[model samples]
Target: MSEVRTIGILGGGQLGRMLSVAASRLGLRCHIYEPGANPPAAEVAHACTTASYEDEAALRAFARSVDVITYEFENIPTSALDLLEDLRPIRPGREALRVSQDRLTEKSFLRDLGLATAPFADVTDAASMTVALDGIGTPAILKTRRLGYDGKGQARLSTPADAEAARAAMNGAPAILEGFVDFSREISVIAARNADGDVACFDPGENLHDNGILRRTTVPAGIPGPMRMDAVLIASKILNALDYVGVLGVELFVTPGGLVVNEIAPRVHNSGHWTQNGCVVDQFEQHIRAVAGWPLGDGARHADVVMENLIGEDMERVPELARRPDTALHLYGKAETRAGRKMGHANIVTAKSS
Candidate 1:
């Protein structure tokens, strides 16, 4: 394979910004293609193409500028990908996106792999929802199959009678009804794979969420050693199944029965943010290495860390947080701060455990 000197990124969010930073560290340039002006990544990337995905000329130009293409998020329009995929390699591949972009498809894929997930059924309308509720029961979550994140595009059904309101919440989008799973806590494994089929998984991190947005992730998750292994194996399993390259984040629920699959992100994950301060190679760098055809780096944890997300009003605590020792703050260069917006994060190293 030819040497890769440039990477083309699909989205220009914080993940893209961090990926670009990591790429630069490795003597690589990143070109960010985003429709939104003043994206966070524009400040860090070597170049930014401000054009809609529908713009074929911009897409072709952007494709010609980079050696490999990767994305910060799923949900890139298929038409855009069809054009770009013909010009350059898209790491993690389209299958990963096809499997992860829809809730129902993701759940079904997990089940087919002999993995455990919450009982889920498809719901397109009132009729299908009634059947889904009948099987999944009440106290369930009705979520749109596509384009939902950070608690958006979801509604909770406390009881069967609340089905109407929950259905209405879907706004006519195809939905899935998931029966609640009894889990002790949420954890995630940030795993990476390269074209050579080698896989490396970081230590699992325990997560805490507020209003569907991740609030904190603590490394050295207070789980048994074996459970941690289980998380890693699960991540590795998915990585291999997809013939995946680059980094993938797998979220799981530690249930009394076993760890249950939650969802997968095909790029560097938020839960792995602590690695920035706690590991020799962070998720962003690992992803760049994998996609750039470099060997994977050691992701072994060298410290105990607590990563906290700075959302909206949390930005007010930045000055106080900066005063604390052993804390590293990574603020996204977002222009505006609004309710539920993720402004930045802090990784607090509690101890050097390695």
Candidate 2:
């Protein structure tokens, strides 16, 4: 057994909540630092710090109280992390956060590493959009440079006439225009890298989306043999490039030509949530092992799985889902359910033939 240490998580959302539960199973305690009271993670953590990221005194206190630090989300302000890093070690480190924070920088960085990404150009104004459109053409996506997720902060331009509309919709934020990818399907690989330079990746999962939010994810993505290997290779490449020391989610588009990276999530991802029932070591537990200097777990799947997101009102079917023997229900303890909010998720597992 490895030495157990108290882990400090920077966010108090559902991801942090799940991570805290996983940490407890390994004899480690988790302290959640969040600005608001009653965050989901707070309920299960050893302690909770209610202070804004700008509170240097609180940040210092929180950092001093933990062995090592990690974050549940990537949108954390860089300055806040810098303050905590001064007091304790932050895994998956600042470089990964910086690169994943900005869409333009992320795409450029991936391209520089000889990775395939959709054709893209920077956009700060109408003229820049016009120029980018001229190069990348229409039917492209215009996305904000920072703080975009779950299909937010993005606009799709189907024609030249939509360029002005797209620019206006972004409200002058620095953005990127990406040429549309004609892909057959979308998939993601959830992988973990440890401080000792070890990496373990789960099987690729096929994904389906509705109105830009992920609706369902099925494992054994049903792609050709080479495509499965290609997906895992792409994810490993991103983890190695970042020198990442935690679980990372790599989203990919399976295009006619080949696999193309769409985005990177620096923490446990929604796509991998099915592992909770399908695999012995779920992404949450795997992440805790990586960040705590413990040996990484085997990521092999023992069952075929399908995970569905319960968006807002869809959570009403929880009672029904929970009654199914093969289904596992996970609900984020949120106060209210608004449209587009992820209220919970359900995973259906089926044992595979040996």
Which candidate number has the best TM-score?
1
TM-score of each: 0.98, 0.97
lDDT tens per residue, model 2, 190-235: 9999999899999999999988899999988979888988888888
Pairs that collide in candidate 1 are none
Give the per-residue lDDT digits (tens) of candidate 1, residues 20-93.
99999899999999999999999999999999999999999999999999999999999999999999999989
Error of 2 at 70 (Å): 0.5
Per-prediction CA RMSD (Å): 1.0, 1.2
TM-score of predicted model 1?
A: 0.98
Off by over 4 Å in 1: none
List residue ranges in candidate 2 displaced over 4 A: 1-4
What C-alpha lDDT do the candidate models reach, one value each?
0.94, 0.91
